[model samples]
Target: MRIQNAFRLALVGTLGVGAGLLILSAVASLSTILTYVGVALFLALGLEPAISGLERRGLPRWAAILLVVLGVAALVAALLLTVIPIIVEQVGELIALIPVIIAQLNRVDWIEWLQEQFPLLKIDEISEQAAAALTDFFTNPDKLSELLGGVWQVALAIGSGVFAVIVVAVLTVYFTASLDAMKRATYQLVPASRRARFADLTEQITQSVGRYVIGQVSLAAVNGVLSFAFLSIIQAPFPAVLAFVAFLFSLVPLVGTLTGSIIIVLACLIPGVGSPLTALVAAIYYLVYMQIEAYVLAPRIMSRAVRVPGALVVVAALAGGALLGILGALVAIPTAAAILLIIKQVVIPRQNER
Candidate 1:
């Protein structure tokens, strides 16, 4: 290598590595801040449409804001009242069976099959293994609360997380009511010559995110209702609880729906509602629903506004789950869709023009 060229190459490599590490450290520290920002943005988007409707109803601006906020508060209050009792009843039923369920696991046919497949596996003592698994599963305070504990604990955890949500709601009201002012402020930040392009990108992102929120809410409602219907048909206990789980998890992208299905399947197995055939029947049911959702349901419900290919949906969901657990996975698809919109706006137009 020529000495000067080698020196330049090494300088560029060092700079790149330095930049990467800086970004990583900044992200680690700033993640909490970014989370609040994303929450505020999503809330603003969802509330903006409702706020607009109120404005068009000849409501004064402050009155419109108050109406929208109060309306949301009423919904939240209703959920707490209506859903908690059902969840608690079902949860008591579930935990009451835990010791019995643990015993039942040792008696499953699959355990013997596993022993035969690896005879020496019992060198670890099969009973001890089962006991240890149960012990560990119930030992973690957070995990156990989510699973084996009373419904009240779960509800308390949910209530604890409500602070961020309340803040987001307050921010959303201010942002939505002043959207036009926000827009003008945003434009002022850009050089006048570049404002048009910036405005277009901003508008595109707003529409995409808004569409995503509305679509997911509608889809979740449908999933919740369908799940309740199926659970009720099978005479499964806790139909309402299962349906509520479906509704909440539905906010998650692809994986959330899958999880809700598996949960219902497990709950049914608890009651022996469809015991031997439960998993198979549940799988087949979702397979049919998945087809309907992919082809007919999403297009009509989501307005083809965010075109997430099936393969990409799975990839994004898995990646999001690996990185940040379930909530990340839920938000990942729409985030991907927004990024794709930006890329298409720049790349596709340029390609066609070329």
Candidate 2:
């Protein structure tokens, strides 16, 4: 009897372990779909504030959602129609100028100055090697084929990206339209005693997320517009393309603006594209812009959106970036806010009772 009981326990334990592993494997397999759902949900939450504002003005929910969605779609269409072609043209120009730029590297005044200052660093030798390698790569048939293969890979990636965008768009509309119902359903999962509190907390968290998203996008738009105007005024190369790059990078929090500014400055220093003076001017402009953004813009825009401590923000951003790259970093602050709220409201109260 004792042997039979032990055998039964071991069999059950083995089965449970196997089931847990199977569940994990299934989750891993569905990771991409899960990511799509998460992104769609995040966007839906971001749009909620707009919907709420329209509702406050006595607009019906359906009409409000429709208006906001159409507005966003129209804005996106306009950008694609006007800006995308210019950016593409600039990119092509940059690529065509690559060989010329490489050949003229030694003619750049700063390069000569750097070589003079650092005699031990064989800058000329390095430039020659790079130019020779590039020339060989362009002439070699095998290298041309490899380049074509890379282009094919890029085409495939673009297609996949388009598909993902469509999926997420559809999902965002569905989620936005049904968010109230979804919240009610989620509230139902809580016990009757806690349902009200849970709903309240959830509302606060969603609002915080919505505000953060709007503020962050506003900041990015500001940077992109200013960058384009400044670069164009200075006749920096590929203003449209660099501005688009700035816009994209500024979507990431914390280090994004700085990183984008550095890239733009480096682009300005490219031989034949811009001179040393141009690079210097661009750097100075970005330095001033960064200070304005950090001191004046960010604090005002983000004050109400998130209230996490400075130290926690740094830690959360780093941890989130490490774990899930850009998406994680984008959501980290609001997630931290939600956690802090729960701790203050629920955990502390429970501990006090204990």
Candidate 3:
């Protein structure tokens, strides 16, 4: 009897260890899958407002979900068809014009001043070396192979991104279609006594998230349009490309607009395409725009959805970006807002009552 009991205990221990290892392995491999699911869930939540509105207007829930999905797909397809070719062509043009830009830079007064002062600045040598290096990289087989390798990596990345997008799209559709069911199922998980409060909190959070996503997208659009206009006014060669960059970067939290604006301004100062005066003008425009966005636009757009302190916004953005790169940065503000809402509604109230 004693031996049998010991044997049973050992068997249980071994099984537990095996199960633990299996679970860890699964988690490690499914990290990316989890990320995709999370992104889709978040996106569904963001689109909930439109879905709810349509349902309120007497449309069937399924029809509203389908409509919202189709509308989003059409918008994305249209944007890709219209903007991709222009960006590609502009990128090629920019690359081809680099030597000319460098040559133009050689004639700048600052170059001459640096040469005169430092004596060892050797601007001509540096320029020549840079030109020669570029020429060699194009003409040399080994260097050309490196370029091809980079292109291959880019292709692989694009393929992976497409796969992720498809997965997210499918999941988003499923989640949006079953959102109410999901909510009810979630509520069922809570204790009967707490379920009502949980439902209310969930609803509030989802509504806030929906508003935030919509507001952020709108703000990004505004930034992109403004950037395009500013670049065109300065005769910047790649206005479309710069604007697109602005649109993408502006999707991130606090630092995104500033980062995009700086990049565009620097592009405007490229020697062959733009003048110092144009760069200065671009800089000034962004400075004023940032202030206006902070004081006026953001408040008008985002205040209703989520209001977080400016310092907290910065901290959250930095931390999120550090942890998960762009996606982290993009979601950080809303996540912070959600956390804040919970603390305010649940924790603080509980503490005060106690």
In order of appearance, the predictions have TM-scores of 0.73, 0.87, 0.83
lDDT of 2 by residue, 137-240 (tens): 99999999999999999999999999999999999999999999999999999999989999999999999999999999999999999999999999999999
Candidate order, TM-score descending: 2, 3, 1
Q: Rank the candidates by lDDT, best first.
A: 2, 3, 1
**Per-prediction count of colliding residue pairs?**
1, 0, 0
Give lDDT tens digits, candidate 3, residues 1-354: 699999999999999999999999998899898889878988888899999999999999889988999999899999999889999999999999989988886677865777888896788788789899999989999999999999999999999999998999999988988989989998999999999999999999899888998898889999998988878877886999999999998887688899988898888877788778888988999899999988999999999988899999899889988987777887888889989999999999999998
User: What's the CA error at residue 346 for candidate 1, in Å?
Assistant: 4.2
**Cα lDDT, all candidates:** 0.77, 0.92, 0.89
lDDT of 2: 0.92
Cα error, residue 206 of model 1, in Å, equals: 0.4
Model 2, stretches more than 4 Å misplaced? 106-149
Candidate 1 regions with alpha-carbon error over 4 angstroms: 1-24, 56-61, 99-174, 177-179, 271-274, 278-280, 308-331, 343-354
**lDDT for each residue of candidate 1 in 264-329, tens digit (9 for 90 to 100):** 677666633337475567667877886787678877987654777778878988897888775567
